[model samples]
Target: MTAKRSKVAPRVATGGGALVPLPVGLSEKEAAQEAYRRLDRRVHARLGAAVGGVSVIGLAQAWGDWASHLALSPGKQMELVWKASRKWQRLAGALGRDPDSE
Candidate 1:
C-alpha cells in the first residue's frame, strides 16, 4: 500500500506576523467596488503621468472634458462624497456590533 500526502493551503502574512484568514461573504457589489478602488489607484497614477507630459493648455482641456463628461458639478461631487461617507459609517457601525448584540 502507498501512503498519501495531504495538501496544504498557502499562508498569507499580516502586519503582525499572524496568518490572517481571507474575508468571506462579500456581495458582488462589494467585490466590484474593491476592484474599482484598485483600478482607480492605477488610473490615477497614469493620469498624473499623462498630465505631467502634456502642455498646460492640453491638461486644462482634458480636465474640462472629464468634468463635463462626468456631469458632476463641484457641489454635486461634494454631496456624493458626504453620502458615501455616511453610508460607510452606517456599515461600519453595523459590522462593529455582534449579530446577537442588543
Candidate 2:
C-alpha cells in the first residue's frame, strides 16, 4: 500500500521562496521549533524594513541639502564637512582599547 499525502495548501509564504504550512499533529518540541523559525523570519523582515527606511530617509535629506547649497552658491562649489562620533566608549575595551585607559 502507498502512503497518501495531504492536499491542504500552505497558509503562509516564507522569504526563502517556499510556502510554510501550519504545524499540525506535531510533537511539542517540533511545534516549538516551527514557531521559532517563523518568529526568526519575521524579525529579519522587520529589521530589513527599518534599515531600508533609514537609508532612504538619509539619502533624501542629503539630496535636499545638496540642492539648497547648489542654489545658494551659483558659481562656487559647496564644501562638505565629515563629522565623526565616538559612541562606543563603553565598548572600547572590547574593540581592542586598553581597559585602564577606558
Candidate 3:
C-alpha cells in the first residue's frame, strides 16, 4: 500500500520586501497632518530657494485654516507655529534673504 502524503504549502524564494501595515490607532486628522509634513519635507528638499516666497506664505495661511478645526491647546499651537517659523527661516536663508526681515 502507498503511504499517505501530507499536505504541503508552496514556498517562495527570498529577497522580495514585505508590505508593512500602518498602525491601527492613528486618526484621520493625524494621518493627514503626517502626510502634509512629509510632502513639505520633499518640497523643501527639492525646491529649496524657490519655495521661500509665495508658496511658504500660502502654506502658513493653509496651516492657520486647518489648525482652527483642531482643539489644540495654546501650548501646542505655539509649538506648531514655532516649528513652522524655523522652516520659514531656513527657506529664507536659502533664498539669500534676511530671515529676521520676515
State each model's CA lDDT, in order: 0.65, 0.62, 0.60
Alpha carbon deviation, residue 11, candidate 2 (Å): 12
lDDT of 1 by residue, 2-102 (tens): 33322333233543567633234444455445556655766666777867756657778998998896685787788889999999999999999999868
Model 2 scores worst on lDDT over the 10 consecutive residues at: 78-87
Q: How high is each candidate's TM-score?
A: 0.32, 0.32, 0.27
How many clashes does each candidate structure show, in the order listed?
Answer: 0, 0, 0
**Total backbone collisions, model 1:** 0
> 2 or 3, which is superior by TM-score?
2
The positional error of residue 95 in candidate 2, measured at the CA in angstroms, is: 41
Model 1 clash pairs? none
lDDT of 3 by residue, 14-61 (tens): 224433333344555554455566557656766766665457668889
Q: Ranking under lDDT, best-scoring first? A: 1, 2, 3
Residue 1 displacement in candidate 1 (angstroms): 65
